[model samples]
Target chain A: MLSVLLASGVANGLLYGLVALGVVVLAKAANAFNFSQGDVMALGGFVSYAVIVTMGYGSVAALPIVVIVALFVGVLSYLLLRPLMDAQHAVALLTATIGLSFLVKGTIRLIWGRQGDYFAVPPLVSGPPIILFDGAVIIPLQHLVMSGGAVLMLALFALFFRFTRLGLFMRSVADNPRAARIVGIPTELVLCSAMVLSLVVSAVAGFLLAPATLIFPDMGFSLFLKGFAAAIIGGMMSLPGAVIGGVLLGVTEVLVSGYISSTAQELSAFVLIFVALIFFPRGLFGGRSSRSV
Target chain B: MKLFSQIVGVMLMTTALAVPAFAQDVQGVSDTSIKIGTFGPITGANYAFGRLTMNGLETLFADVNAAGGVNGRTLELVRVDDQCDPAGAIAAVRKLIFDDQVFAIIGGSCSNGVMAAKEDIEQSGIPFVNFAAASNNISAPEIENIFTSMLTSNLESALQAQYLSDLGVKRVAVVAQHDAWGSDRHKTLLPALAEKGIEVAVDEELSMEANDATAQVLRVQGSGAEAVVLLSYPKPASIFLRDAARLGFTSSFIGTSVIPDPVAFDEQVAVPGATDNFVTISPSRYALDSAEAAEWLEKLTTKFPDDEPHTYNLYGITAGQLTVAALEQAGADLTQASFIAALEATSGLETTFAPGPLNCETHQCLQAAAWIKRTPEGKTEVVGLSTLD
Candidate 1:
């Protein structure tokens, strides 16, 4: 049971963390929650699916093309997000993201029509499900894929921020865009890069999620809400916090639904979020950072 | 005041004439245009159900109209997006029946949304054939004006317990949504379980909007149960299955129709990882080998090319087919009474009807009808099908 739970949690958490990363990138870089982050995730999954199925690209061959497509989509989404960034309350940004979410979901409807697609996909992660504790539960090879991708993404993100000049400039802008601008930083470019990175993360999350959940236009709305909840529980601005929140949330949900009422599942999550807000307003592992710096 | 009086007078005249052709039956809705109306959500959380529902309705209408119309009157459908809200449902019904002057109505995606507006539907006086909304309360005690095209959730849960018992699974954990509908399932299922000498190890409730089911998974896993029964919608159902794996809950999972969406199998049902020991019940099955089913599917898909033919897609098409059969029995130059009588006279008529006692004496869906589906090899295969005896 332990092995299976950890395996599933790691995979589920990693996908969620990727979504949270998108939220973190936007929130940290531009102080906004891309409400459409969920739809973007759904869009990434479907786009790759189309590339593989309709365009006849093998899933392995589709990877590079998917990345390029994801980047282009990220740029387009960034351009869309630009106007909303300047709004005073940030609610404008939220609404715009929501609108984009709706639009993308609607567009998916137009494309897929109304039926559930039953597609056959190959095993991305190799090896058998590792069973532990007298074979009580088993962990599948996909867990490795999920774990490796999550750790790799986080490492890449950290490395990019730690040493690269572009990363440093972006960090300065995120920490204080006005100050960075005063120091001759190109704020627009920084924001654009944030959008690009956010979308890339979102696309990978979508690709990972598609294998188990399959592709549906409406799937994004739920993913968006979950990602949003994870971001909120993780302080809405911290990458590590978002990662922790995603895993914590994924694990909590499993325990709750297994033991308690499924109806009370969301109720309990809200209770946890509410309690966290009251006690540790900055979330677990949070520190105060000021854009005014 | 005079204008209001005039409007009332006009309505009265329209009603009177419309009823018996005394003066109000304005349009000749014949072979070129037989108008029907539907209400569904164009916005909100459950909006996808409505959108897909609309697609099915439109496709079926086109199919019916193409096959030489119903009694020589072409089928025409008018739609109003209700956004799946109660207040919105009421307004959509009013607009369709009162304003659009449709002959009949079939528009339900959510039970709560429809149940809230039942009185408004009763008041409408138009024949209402529901394509969705699976609550017995919708048709209980025989409203006469309204009828459903699917099985109620109560029977659905009982059937789940019965099927599990048949499979020799004794101990089970039931996870359900925490709403009136989900609660209704819990209330119905426990008694059904007890009667069958089966014990519920863990009975849990989760919210429809939840993203994970960790706590719920732990309780079910800790309950020492072999199988887990889920009475949930799609969103939580997906989270539950995925999270169940993450929590090391290796118990077999059996879910309601809400989660057996075939597309999810192709998308994220993560079969080998997420779907081992998982099986679910769909409303009915269309085995590729079942001649009637294959013919029906072919006709339906061809007729309504725009709709994705899911389980519910079949429901709408079946009901439409039943109505068509009833209308045919009504003969040309039919009236409302003749149409009702034709439907009442059905004995063993199996025109897209699932296996159930078609007493026709009671307008209720007698017994439950469903088939079990499993993603054994990345395909949603109907392993077995039966109607409750």
Candidate 2:
């Protein structure tokens, strides 16, 4: 029973981690949290459902379609918010993203709200659970795919940020925007690129997670809250810290529901956030610097 | 002298026309049409419940109109979207009553939404035949001019308890969502269980959008429960059953009309032999796609080409049928009082989708519930029908 709980906790942790990665990326590059990140995830899930289920495109075909849609959304958001990003403070920019979130959520409702309570995506693989420990621990194949896919995507993101030219440019922009601007870095382009990168990451998370969780317009807000909590707990600016925090939060939530009470499960995140804010302040792995990667 | 004669003729003609209008002074009632209004969530997450139910009502109205109308007056429906919220339901009901001046109303998809607007409905004195919304409070206080065609939550909960008792199953556990809909039923279920001399071994709460139920399931299993009552929607219920199956824990899983379609439930579970011990109570005897509902499905599809028929649609169809029956019984002089009297007098009326006779002798119109099970071959079969005590 303990092993099963741990496995389930880790599986959900991976999903939270993926969402936190998007939050961390945007927070680092733009110095503003994208309140609309969850809505972007929702839109991605709905688009994938449309392509794969409604449009009769195969699963493999859904990948490129999802990418194209994500790119368009990312670019459009960047263009629309460019003026606000240039003229407004971080708080105002964050507020504008909240508006954008509502707009996107409403638009999705108008187009696909009638689909039903939820749209299901067939798992990447289908079969019975793989039993371990003399049938004590059982994990679904879809869960394994979700956890593994999340890890692979995170690893690739880490590599892109560390070694690539654009990655270094984004890092430099995060470190000191004024300095990067003086050194001939196209700061606006870097910001736009970050927005696109965040959205793309959100789309990937939505697609991978939709199989385990059903796709719906309202699915975004709760997920965004969880991911945000994960980011905050892991030190909102630290990518690796975000991942670690997400896993820790997820495991804690599952265990709370498993051992304590389900009502406590819902309250656990808020409690964790409260305690982390009061004690750690910088979070588990958060550094002394305000900006981190 | 000629002008005086002309004036007299005009006055006489006016008086003649006014007399007949006074004789039949009901709002929304013309010589050729009777207007009824419906309110539900037509454009939000709960759109399926509202829009599809309206589609069913519209199809019935069309059929009634096509069959030479009801009492020589065509049935017309005015629809308003409540968005499945209490404030929205109240405003929509008020608008339908005052602005639209509908003679009657036949809609309410969400329980809390309907209950929130119940005061307005009762005070308006407009005859209402609720199509959906299963909270017992909607009709419990016995409000005049208000009747519900859907089975009440208390009745369904009582029946679920009765089913467990009949099977001789002891040590029952309940896993329920804490949302309004689930809570309403859960509150009623405890008393019903006690009436049968049973005590719940364990009780757990789940969220409507929960992705995992391993914790809840493990706790229930550890409590030595032989049966589990699941008061949940399809998603959470499916997850709980799947997890239970994974742990090799098989117990009799009982559900209510929330999971009307066993076949869909099985698919959502996505585990072989997971739902073998599952049983659910449905207000209707047949699934929307079943042979018994072919005619309803045809009418629904023809009326709404883009929308598909669902079990929620069946609720609307039954409500529509009940409304038409009441209107027909009210005769050509269709006043609100006459309609209420006719509805109260309704009993043992057969409907296409309802499991048994729709009885409105009480404020609760529908009392019968059907037990449905999915066989190993993935076929849904009606096990038995019971009228709630």
Every candidate's lDDT: 0.68, 0.83
lDDT of 1 by residue, B1-389 (tens): 67864574466345524665653332324545657777877555465566666665676677777788877777777888888888888778767766787766777777877887776666545667676777877877677667766667777767877887887888988888868878877788888888777889988776655434555676777889888887876555666776565445687777776654543542454434666666777655553224656655676567656554555566566566656666678777665556667666655556454544343445554345555554545555665655554
lDDT of 2 at A102: 90
Interface RMSD of the candidates, in order:
5.9, 2.4
Model 2 C-alpha lDDT per residue in residues B87-196, reported as the tens digit of each score: 99988987887688788899998898999888677766778888888889899878887899988999999888888888887779999999878899999999999998
Total clashing pairs for each candidate: 56, 0
- Tens-place lDDT per residue, model 1, A1-293, is 45555665666777777788788887778887776677778777777677776677766765666568668877887888788777484887778877877777787767764334323334455454666677786766666676776778778888988998878888898788889999998888888888888877877777766644445566677776667677778878777888887877766655454444445555655776788778878876567645773
TM-score of chain B of each: 0.84, 0.91
Separate DockQ for every predicted complex:
0.22, 0.44
- lDDT for A226 (candidate 2): 87
User: Which run of 10 residues does model 1 chain B get worst, by summed lDDT?
Assistant: B23-32
Q: Pick the candidate with the highest lDDT.
A: 2
Model 1 lDDT, full chain set = 0.68
Span of ten consecutive residues with least summed lDDT in model 2 chain A: A115-124
